[model samples]
Target: MSQTLKQPRNSTERAGFRVDLQGLRALAVLLVMCYHIWFSKVSGGVDIFLMLSAFFLTSSTARRIARGQRPPLVDGWLHRFSRLIPQAAVVIIGVVIAAWIILPSTRWLELIDQSSASLFYWQNWYLSDHQVDYYAFNTASASPLQHFWSLSVQGQIFILWPLVLAGSALIWKKFFSRHNFAWVAGSAFGAIFIGSLAFSIYITATNQQVAYFHTGARLWEFALGSLLALALPWLSSLPEKIRRFGGWAGLLTVIGSGAVLDVQGQFPGFMALVPTVAAALVIAAPAPRSWTNPSGLLSLSPLVKLGDLSYGMYLWHWPLLVFYLEVSGKQKASFLAGTVLILVSIAASWCATKFIEKPAIAWQASASFSRLIPQSGFKLIAQFAAVAVGLGVASLPVMAWENNVEHRRAMAAAQTATDNPGANATEGWDPSPTSLVLPLATELDSEWQTPGEVCEGAAAPDDERIRFCEQGGTFDGGAPDLVLLGDSHMQHWSAAASAMIEEAGGSWILVYEPGCRYGSDADRVKETCSDFQDAAQDYVADLAPEMVLTTASKTVARPDAMLRSPGEQEILVDNYEAMIQPLLDAGSRVIAMRDTPRYSYSIPECVDSNKDNFANCDGSVGYALNSVNPVEKFLDSRDYGDQVVSLDMTGLLCPEGVCKAVIGNVLTYLDDSHLSKTFVLSAKNQFASSFKEATNWE
Candidate 1:
């Protein structure tokens, strides 16, 4: 992409003609395109591309300095970003509008956040912070901006690289060889390569997900390219056959990387060296001899043209793939369908490059604008202002519309509350299935403020401590507690429990671990969750809490076992028994509420598409009711002491032979299994009465 850079005339003449590199760009982008569209694989193409970008940037900057043309740092920054932002902003804006129109409103806030993060090139961090399961294409909708992670990494390097180059130049001129600028730069890059490589290896091994998007872990690839650029003069001096051999070998490596390696899971570590070094060999190889130089294929006119459009292709392909998936509702596409999407992506890329990218670059390059403006950064200011305005325009209205829908739904739910033939909710929870109060499309972000506001992982001295919460918004540390234990199923029921505990009069402690089923003494694998359960056992034993409320369940479908075994059921009961054994011995009764229904798809998405008939999204009563179908049977087989009382919510949730997505205007489940805090709150009256009857709570 030297063509993208504006080099000094002398430097352009001397460092001119690496059409091979342009061809490499085309190859890289195409690999990413095909893999994303059809194969659902990572190609290592982005890694190679990152290295090539750094190589060219470093080489161009060094050449400018050698020619005594002062490195126009601010101007370079502006030029690169301006060249980038127009195309990127266009894609982001297009995606924003597309998401609003095509996707259910449940997806709006995330898309908005992604768009804003992409605009500032902090997408990688944003996604990581949100703990998005980047690998889970089957379970979750892939964000269109997910591919921006690489762009964001490159953007960070683009800003920081020039400063490092300038500093290295100063040290070389003042102390090191003045004429041997390449040696100084290469040595600097060599050191960076070593340090960054070590860090990359460590981070990738321990935390591959975070390492995958981390700019720090990726710095080695860029440094490897810079090292190659500075060593090109020596490599070019090699025997013609050797250099030609290197080129062919490198080309094969670049093309075959995806086939040979698991690039997605083990990237930017030592594994990344395969493609980066191959790209280096290609860049360093001298002008190819007629003896079958792969450069000839790479430098083909059409390939080079595609290379020019590579950036746009990279930007456009992902959103198109995501849009297609959203429409198709399939995890992977068929070859024919994927091909059409790819072809359209290519066409879109070409138009964007020709009409938007090329014109924008030309204008920015030809402008009379001062590079000094970037010192004060009007560009950043303008970009943030644009994002703020865009988000306000995009999100505020959606919020209002969702709010209005929720308000009307709430009114309907109120009527349902009055009209329903309430059952013996305590003996067996059966509010008799009223209408859903909240819209199926409602995100219930406000309602998600449970299991309570301050809930999180254990927080002190690298030691996990039990979590305590009080009814009526107070947490007294030394109170005889009403403990809620187990996973998110147990966590979600806190709304009802807290209200009942407050009415019954005592402080309540919520000992919740999201994924763990309250297994004890190493039965749980996650250290924090395991520790939370152990700590809960210890606390309940000593405190002798009046009641320990928990659910015996798992949210993910155990299809193999749901009908046959509940293979997880034995594990669930064992963990629960162990957890409450100590509490039972200490005279504390265990209140085992059964888990709710689990669905395969997003309930909100289903509801949005089928609003007037939400039962369309409902699952069969036999398949859906965990508490009644499997949990009750399992509980009957166990003798967890007489004080241990089992509560089934299935009667309330599955009143008409189907477990519906919405009940009493309360969206029953937040995702697919766990009840929404609002739904729990709505059913609290019945829950309290049940508690008073079952345990004789005062």
Candidate 2:
């Protein structure tokens, strides 16, 4: 239910005749829908759509060049975008309203950003930078507007394809004035197809996830369609028998390819040739060469009618599917529900095409809508103004609505904790610190002191010039005596650590790096991590504290990528011992606490949506721990004697083997892996009691 690709671009319109391409459009859309709804497989429908768009685009440009009326680049670009964006605008506005009503507030920021990216034609690039998981759908949430990535790609190409045609027109005027521009254009596109196909095959093999959404990686599909537009005239000369066989073969191949091909890493490569060529064969089949054209079956009324609405259908289906999944709380829709969704999408598509798209296109093409005045020279300016004004007007309300909602929530949260005098002494076990009331999600942190103290992403020089900076201390009539260390996992616990240091009448030193787990005998560390670890060793040796506290395990790695076998676990334990044993040797007691449990989805959003009984977000400790915490499992399974203190804090977070996102009316974790500072500060007394028992201090 995540995505479907369709091609109802009206491809045959450029020839000034209905070549029955609408039938192909109907077929392509149905293939995409069935694959997305039920099969959980890609049908090569997106590749075919890419080809069809190029096919029509090249045909129209060639016809103009053939008649010596070269396509005006800016005007063509305006019309192309105008044809597409209105329907897309309607869908985006609808999704914005639905998101505000149904989706959790935590998702609002990302959804708003995606809506902006969709309005502009950069969603594909945005998704690429984010490293979106296009292949899988998690149980908790799916981006309702994720399908806009394809539309963004198409829009970018629509703008650029005209420039390509313009280039061909330049070549025709300069070098080959005698020959028709078709040959010159065909030869140029032919070379492009060869080069881009090679690039596509290489990148797809190397990184399919990135290449899947990358415009450069899929340009070859468009190039092939451009070349086919020129070649179709020559191909039309084939006899009736051969053309009939090819038409049938192409139709059958389009229907059957999805059933056989597994398009994981193998797409947009040579495998994508199946659908692109099938669609080309259907386009090139000569219907007028014979009386009984079996391909005439495409001229049927119902299929043509569906094709008329295919673009709108593609836009409408995915958000509906995603919203249904959100409201119904089902990962995949039941058969009955999916059928109902399909029917509703069809109805919506009909309305969008009939009432919105057709009328908008007609109006935009009118003399008044397209010209600043009755004058001729200002048409481009007029087109720009109209498209810009139309989109600006459509999107501003959505922007204002989300902003108002966020402002109200923030204002309400700001009203808590007016006094700021003292902690509540008589609350339940592990209560949130009542001294300073927190926002619902506790999004801000006062004790955060990691990246600003150190140049987080900077690499160390070959020679040492202060490799890392150290920060965090309190000198309230007492000497500094505590030093905390490790990756972000250790960093997030600063709230509890700060409270403990204050109670013990001392200050603190915090040495941390992002994602740089303190490892010694494992895979190679980044240069910065290795340098930080060395500097940390020297600092601890120079100013040895009473105790060195650090996290010994992490749950940030995905389950598939983690090492879980006993042999792998032993290596992790070896790395942990090697990393922390130096502090213990430096005349400082070291406590390596068992890392906290992780969640598969964001905890705050789940709690926000299910607020009536937030316990519905309880995840089993097994899933909470998952595969990445085996180092803790290995450390806890055996004895390392008294040199290293191995403290287990899992039970305080996960009582009775269930790790709920909420406890004591405050969210336990802000996100998937990190505990919120507010929640940790809430547990200050518990942390004091545990530290005292483990170290026999105070």
Candidate 3:
């Protein structure tokens, strides 16, 4: 019970029943900040936020339904959109512009595509396709919009919740209710909350990262808050002492959960209940009659201020941290620098709320943007125009850049130079090692850094590659031909090799591992690798292909984790033998291409920073070769002769034993390993020659 939050009209009685609900808002924001900044122990803040969202939405909707009128669905949706869009749009546009200024072509286009997808609320699907693990270190992904997954989940909930609540209220009134909908709704809501929480716990224990990030598993926290709002009336009647005790208990629960819970293991399941229930208790607590209430602590000016800006603060902070780290090339700094970032983010948020959000919302509510008519009105036209223009803007860049000749050439050259060994030994290595290279402060792509297109018979899809292959058919023409089976890395060569196969009149069968490894024997790729291998084996058995083309062993597919050091070629050779034994037994020759070199630093990151000078990107091919495993030990021990030819990329990919990201005018690889779609298209000639030599394609 907070006395400071309760005001007495006269000396005789406490006039207001205020429990300082807004004060709890401050605590919620602090919990979030602490979790993001340093503490990973608790997820109390997200739960608190979820509870608040549910309570506020339910309370507002209940009031509307009680008035015998349906809730304004469009208005409610617009209100949410108005509140969120301004700051979000600003951040997105800011990221895009920043990316345009500093990022390399290989990175810029992909980030642009991702950002566009994210803005349209398609980020989750895109991430799933990219296999972007949400729980993985943030450094692994370069997208500023990755954090928006939570926002998307919240939006999804807002879309469905109001309608369900309204529909339920109407049903109850016509059937069981004696004109009382709140209690019925509350009871039904409680059931739903409990069920969802149970499901969350089950899913979290089974697969926590997906459960934690997914909306279905998290909706129960919000439902719990709505339930608390329904019970608040009964709680208000309790004695002051009891209310005070409840308040203290609630505060402790929130703080304690924040201090104890960790997001690393099982989370947002049963663990989330601690914070949700605590927040509910705080909201339900009665007002104090004297100066003894502890709620005042949260109501302090600074905390309240932070609470007010919490929404915008959440949106701006992560991107700022990302950009700062990108520019500085450093990890998070001391408290002072972080505090400054928070303050700056808060200030920026305030400005965004003032100039963009408030104005947009106010204007939208006015008669100008409002549609009195349901359809075929000026408002509808305006909405159509906005959508059309946004789509047009997004599509134009993709169209324009996809056809650029120089860009295409650069991309092709990069693919050939980075993935296949050619006559040019120094094709992709940076020449001037002693020259100083300044890190670019912005993320932009120039024409010189673009890639070609996806390989021809490759499963890789691009604007240019249009041919589709059925699972059982011959790719180019006949049996005793070539068959390429692998992941995206394998798909990268379709254009080049498929053309040669067509010319040679030999069939090229292609089967790509979607979320699977290429090798048949690697058990670590248990997800889909085994299935892919089974399919390939069946295909190879049916087709009786003369040669099977695949890449070096995947790092993940390695049997042991200690293979990171030099001179491990034998371990890799063992991995290859395991993948090839079945193919050999089936009377097919297996040719293994050496894996492409990864930049010494993160590829997309360097591309994001526009690091043209390759010092950071330079890595030793010998090290990459050594990464193969115990070389001599395996080679001497094995009898699989001329059948196993290493199509080493070092001839074109590295010079003087060093591999680099940039060569002459072209960016080497699109990402760390996969050749860019555009680059793959350009490399057709070189790749064709290699395939001919490896399998006698012509």
For every candidate, C-alpha RMSD to the true structure in Å: 5.8, 6.5, 8.3
TM-score for each candidate, following the candidate numbering: 0.84, 0.78, 0.72
Sort by TM-score, best first: what order? 1, 2, 3
Q: What lDDT does model 3 reach?
A: 0.58
List, residue by residue over 173-264, the lDDT tens digit for candidate 2: 99998997889998888888888888888888888777888888778888899998888888888876787778778878888888888764
- As for TM-score, the candidate ahead, 1 or 3, is 1
| Model 1 Cα lDDT, one tens digit per residue, 1-698 | 22232222233135365766667788888888888888898899999878877887888898898887777577677656656676677777778767777887666667666776787789988776665441222235689889888888888888898988888888887898546888878877888889999999998999887889888899999898888878888887888778778888988898899889999889879999998888777776766524377777777877777777788788888999899888887888889988898788779877866786666544433444466675336554444343344445445444554455566567555664443322322333343344443533444555542544444222111224554432333445553457776666677778888887766556676656656677544446777776777776675567676678877654345456345433233334455565667878888887777667677676777777776777888887665443344445656788654587777666677776777676644567666666666667777887777767766667
**Alpha-carbon local distance difference test for all models:** 0.69, 0.68, 0.58
**Candidate maximizing TM-score:** 1
Residue-level lDDT of model 3, residues 307-329, one tens digit each, is: 55667777777677667666676
Query: What local lDDT does model 2 show for residue 510?
Result: 65
- Clashing pairs in model 1, backbone N/Cα/C closer than 3 A: 426-690, 435-664, 436-665, 437-664, 437-665, 437-666, 438-665
Tell me the spans in candidate 2 whose CA falls farther than 4 Å from its real position.
1-16, 132-140, 238-246, 288-294, 365-386, 405-413, 416-452, 455-488, 498-588, 598-601, 615-642, 650-660, 663-665, 681-689, 696-698
- After TM-score superposition, the amount by which residue 479's alpha carbon in candidate 2 deviates from its true location, in angstroms, is 16
In model 3, what lDDT does residue 659 have? 67
TM-score of 2: 0.78
